[model samples]
Target: MTQTTEFDWRPFLLRWSGEWSDWSDSRSDDETRSEGDEAARQGRWLGFPPASEERIVAMEKRLGRQMPPSYRQFLKVSDGWQHAGGFVWLLAGTTDARWHDNESGLADMFEEDLDEDAGPDERRDAEIWRRGLQLEVESDATYVLMDPEDVDDDGEWAVYTWAGWRAAPPERYANFAEFMRDMHREFHSLRAHRTEGEPEFANDTTRELDALVEKARLMALRGEWERAGRTLDEAKEYGRPRAVGLGDQIRRLLGQTYMVYFEDVVTDPRYAPELLPSLVAEHAAHSYRDDSTLMFHLRGAGDDVVSSAYATLERVRDGTYRYTAAGPFGEAVERARELARWGDTDGAWRTLMDALPLWQPLGPDHLAPMGWVADPLLGPLLTPDRGRELLSTPRGGQAGEAPARSAGLDADNLTWLADPDAHDNLTSYRFVLVEGVAPEDLPGRLADGDEAALDDPMTSDEARRRSLGGQREFSSYDDRALMSVGRAGDRWSFAFDGDPAHFDPRRFVSPAAAAAAAATAAGAGARAVVVWSGLRTWRGNPFFHLSVARDGAERYAFTYADAEIHRTGEIPRALDPDRFFGSGSGKVEGEGHAEAERSLLEAVTGEFGVHLPRHAITNGRLHTFTSRSWTRAPGNGETYAVISLNLVRE
Candidate 1:
């Protein structure tokens, strides 16, 4: 006969499940007797064949060490539960090994003595005993059943406890190669339930590890790199033994966070300096690569970041940035540098002015260079004269003209009159004249006396009335002369018809001194002087020739009448000697002859008390002459006709 090979099912049975017990003494009479009888009738549970006395004795002899009472009792019982294609066994037993009693039999005591009530102290001791028993159970249960092919049937079984039931495939693998294979196969099916399944098994260390891995992935989605890295760290700490390839996961997340932090810093450009060091340190601690480029950009050792940013802009010219929006700081810095180089202090000032409206909300440190730029920019815009002008007048409004008096003549009113540029324009000057004594008293009364009369209460309204009264008589000073005088106490009042021309006393003391002499001659109180000057014609002279335009021998000629100043002397001399004279001849045709002549006479007489005689030697001729004493050079006493003629030909 051929040699027969017999397969012992014992190893498979032991590997399939933990021990089971019948609870022969402790079970209820109906359930225990029935279930035990049923299991015996069934004949095979976990492939043990039957719990016969002969089998027990054989196992004990083979193993050498006495099996714990719990194991014997468990073998005598019905199988417990089935899972993952195998049965799990529950054992019941007692031990007399005192030291081992706490280690192996504590669970037996709890199961057998259910009616025992212990005091707090006894309860505490029982808890301690239970803890020891738990440790033993865990140790006995610890085994990793490799693939079935790896089990050795002939190996010594003395040191091996029965392998527990295979409940399910382990949720995570300890070996990386196996894990990757499992992950690939389960990747899709496992992912659908991961969010719900992970937390359900969260109390298990292995499940918590899975949960953390998922959490890191979710954080990555939200761009929360820092938080993702921290979650990966926790997963590594808890899942080190069971989490396959977790180290790589953690490393990848840390690297991601490092890059993200650098990107954030570069984009914002405004984080506090104190934060940068901490950020860089975190990246370094994580062993992140690519820090060199970030460090160079932030620390400015290699190609200043601002300059580099500007260099990248294609449309920007001068100091202004265009196209992209990320470079205001770079633009501002470039603008400041350009302003400094070009010496455009005012342009710089304006730039800062424009920037203030834009940058007011920025923090002081960020705005520091701008503030520094403003000082140098503004320095050149201010000067003493400009400062005075700014202080004296409204920024962009009209300035106040000289103030006019209501009654008495105010010397202060003469202040603006001294300006030679003052004209008849309403914007130029304002004049107020006061009248008191009648015009008939001018021959004998001093200007000071007239001024005193003008100050009198009774004469104040009269002075105002008279000053305005002559306004309609003369369109301007050139038309007619206006005079007024008043007196009251020591106040003096004097008025003139037209705008007075003020002469510097230092330059022409004669007129001022003569006026003073006249005032002294009249009285010590006040004085007034009135004079009227008009136009005079000139003689037929070559200098006064009119221009003729040739039009085929039919000439069109026109002559302009001009005015001449005769004498600007004392009042008595101007009126008495008849020394004033002028020359003009022939009919004249000119646009502004009358007005120009009147204006010329008024200008000269107003400046130097002079009047020209009104008489013509011709129908009209444009000629100008002065009295013997009032020549081109008054001191030279040379008198002659002066004219400018133009002739036009087509």
Candidate 2:
């Protein structure tokens, strides 16, 4: 039941999507009928039937977001599929695939321990739903939640699953595709084992759960709470309808996610006992890595519960995060006074919402101070009589999806177009040809004569690579690409990457900035100018395909938390397309980006006769550079002349 990094989900999605279908039109009547009969015999899964587009659209509207590509396509093949009586359980269909509501939530497993006086209001369920959309799988006992809120740049949400048992924290998969792909294999293996009498994970379901718990324990010891939490959830299902000693041990291990390890979170030697009584006081508000900062802030609160709550609230607004993975929430609001203070304030409204469950154990004496705030995850924390009022809110639309682009260009030449969370690597050819418009007939460029007109900052090639690398996982600036083009003298320079804290990008002052810069670099009479950039993930994964990794330092999808701004009117109307290719505006990546580039080339070559070529390595020359090195290898002596040429960054 532990989430694994070993599966390559892309291939599986393709195979499943194309595997079984309405018999091909080209097949003979007898062959088609036989295939159809066989599929019908297999029933739900083997006879996969794609759901209607209208149905998918309606489902997306109901959920208020898009489903992961593989999941959506899987539905196209089989709107719903199920397997019973073994490790495989219930897999919900389009009709039943809805986000969990306030009433029928898995968190209710904690009901026995919750006090009526201070327990979280119905809205807590709604809040959790905002962060993740739940889909039932496997006997209604286990469920997977799609976390679109914390996605990589490529719009792939990390998938987490939990068994509906008291205190079962969810474990995670890299994406919905991975979950589907791996789950398929697991079911096949489990079924095989059951039929073969192997018996490890088949007939004895409890033993299977036991092995899962062991795996989780090992993961927890190694600091992988997502999988650890996940495996334990599966174990909880094994002991369902009755509590087990094993589940208790699982909770203790999962608790490590929020607890500081053998050290004070506030990091101050002076306040020996931290201001927050428990290590979890600030766990939800900030990363555990910031021990010094947490200690400094926690020290300011002294021992007062109200002070600690307020401080945590402030920090949450200031932007703190739980590192690597999220932790189990709604378990600790035992403090009444602190909850009361947060319930009334604007400063820590979000913190209050996240921590409300902790305070549910308090009496009505603490009720007077509780209230509402404008939050995406806003819940019914206070009773109706307490009142819902406007309060401080984070900037809305932070996670909005990009609108569909209306530019009707046919996708033919291009292979893929990813809405890159940010800039491009100059390692491979990925020249961004903006729009299909001609610069000659338009207004002045986005930038003009002075450096002031081109306000975008320039940096080292290393900076470009670093920015792109970090974005392959989760990053703040994973939206738009600010394509910067410049020239010092005879050589043209360009580096397209994400926005970095240390770098700034120049805006266009005239329609001719980029074109004119290229023309100027090649000298006035030059017929064409070469512009180029490379493609790479932040971790330097090869361009054009998704790479699943255990962490950000390796290849993963280009997942970003926000939408791109490039599709807006930011680029010059003269040189920019209504929507850049690969903006995720109803277009796939590989083909979208490629076709967009091709169309742009057609327009530029036909209108401006601009010649695009390999990237230039040096400021004085245009070519790819490999760090200025040479190796003496044995060579066939056919060519004799020595040559000199300008190089670009390799």
Candidate 3:
């Protein structure tokens, strides 16, 4: 059905009532059960009998206005409804619906809220509340109102919901039909959380809608854009739950939206210059109405480089900026910017997408390419075929020069921690080593006997598969860490965890803290070392880190990336930088980065007397735990991103 069609509310109402009846039948309460039985015996459920046309017309005449077509038609099907939504006990029938008398001084409060700074929408919202018809017969300070003056061409009155407990302004709807349909979906969502077993709507239509959404998702992943768009459109008409999000994603890839933000997008070394101008312009345009000053608040959050970037973005947004990037991909981005300036969004998106796979980092600070598997818009565009080509193709070399192979680390040296596919473009791996801990006891120790460690242990492969499966719905960063644990050496235990396609350092606990926690979990005089090494997917930069902790305190941490070495805390002589690099200074003078990292790891293994069984890490199973115990809480300002590097170079 289309938006303009007279939506059939009867089926939704019937299904809702049926579900409620089933729930009622399952209830243990004697009074409620007897009431439900009496209603079933009387051939009636929760909904009221249909109102006669004459009765509806009389009520309309008394009110001196016509009720919205949707609401009037709804009364014809059922005079009133019970449990309209969230604590809404009863909806008004023709006999009960009336003009809301401002007895609670709600209109006065609305008027007080409309100060000199209020926008057109806010003013309209306040005016409607004073004049709208009240629909709720019983509620906990919640209201469903219809504004007679806010009529559409189709004679549909705008609906508004005002709840005293809600911190935000009243929510508005285009019409009653949309509101009811949303409530029905809300019913299903709520029921899905409270109960399980049968479908929310055990009908062919629900199954069809679900199947259509699933098909659209698969189509999008396969880069069947046009087909996926059309399928999602069809699913949206069916009111499928995931259709809206999928449709938004498709629209984003089609250049109908831009990914602009204060940090993630702007701080990204790639595409920031191309995207910041648009972000600034959009923020400026909406600042008056929404007060969402994303760019405005970024003043002085970083160094001169950040400030310079901001200034450049402001100039670009104001049409006074000048610069032309110098390479094939850069030139393509410049052309896209020009097309975007001329409002040729279609051309802009086409040019950008065509050059995306060829993207190389501008500098050492540009850690990864513009888009990879996790990007909501660009990711889907890089289908399996395109992805394979993108990964296999090497980037960054003199023009006409034969592409050289990437330097491979000697896997035999770090066999226990070596990635079998270390040369694979998308491969990433992480593991923690704790001294004085057993494989079976490590999970409990690491989690400090938290309930999160209560799950039956899983194998390393099984845990990795689950983390990468996309079926695990993590509500928080803490839920993101699911790791497998195993014995390393006689005195050491190792743990492994998987990383999602979207890697955010902010979502993780500090590497040092993670290492420290492992040591603490092993009790007195325990030592823990953690190592994380990986290449960002598809010919991206290599990142490697090593941290050591003893007796619950971090001792040393070293990071090798961004063309710089970051060291925290004093280096112990046993794992000395001079001995490992032979420079006597921690600088790579005459060796490749892969060799340097391998040498560093070799020193740590040789000194600490810690090593993992290669077979156990590569092919064997190990016990697992959900690693939420050490996850950093971003909301509490314990964000891993903001944590200082505490770099102490020696």
Q: Top TM-score: which candidate number?
A: 3
Per-model CA lDDT versus the true structure: 0.29, 0.36, 0.57
Tens digit per residue, CA lDDT, model 2, 1-650: 32233345344534332322221232344553454334543441342356898989898898788886656766776776543223334566677676665334545544444456644433333344445676655454565677675566556677766554635445666676667655654543333323233333333444455566665544433334345556655554443211122233223222322333222222332322222222333343355444455544444344554354445455434323111111222222223222222121121233433332223212211111111111111212222221221111111112112222222121222222222421253323322222322222111222223211222122335334543554434322222233333221122222222232211112111112232322232244212222221223243322221111111122111211112222222232333443343445434354444454445445434443333221111111111111100112224653334333444688
TM-score quality measure for candidate 3: 0.39
- Which wins on lDDT, candidate 1 or candidate 2? 2
Consecutive 10-residue window with the lowest summed lDDT within model 3: 371-380
Encode model 3's per-residue lDDT on 281-385: one tens digit a residue: 445445553533563545434454366555754553343454444567767767755433322333444565556445554542232233222211122233333
TM-score, structure 2 vs. true: 0.24
lDDT of 1 by residue, 1-650 (tens): 11111323244334222221221222334653445334533443422334565655665565344443323443444222222111112221122111223444444554454456755433433333433221121123432111211113322111111233434322322221232222222322232233432422222334555676665544433334346556655554433321222223223222223333322233233432212332333434443444455454355323444343334221111212221112353355447434422223333334433332222212211211211311222222333332222222211112232122112111222222322333232111111111223322332332333332322111222334555553433221121112222221123222232222221111211111122223233344222222222112222221111111111121221222233222232323322212222234333234233343334334434433322111000010111110011001323543434443455699
Greater-TM-score candidate between 1 and 3: 3
Measured against the true structure, the TM-scores of the candidates, in listed sequence, are 0.15, 0.24, 0.39
What's the distance in Å from true for residue 419, model 1? Answer: 14
In model 3, how large is the Cα lDDT of residue 280? 49
| Model 2 regions lying over 4 Å from their true place | 1-44, 84-88, 108-131, 137-140, 165-167, 192-650
TM match of model 1 to true structure: 0.15
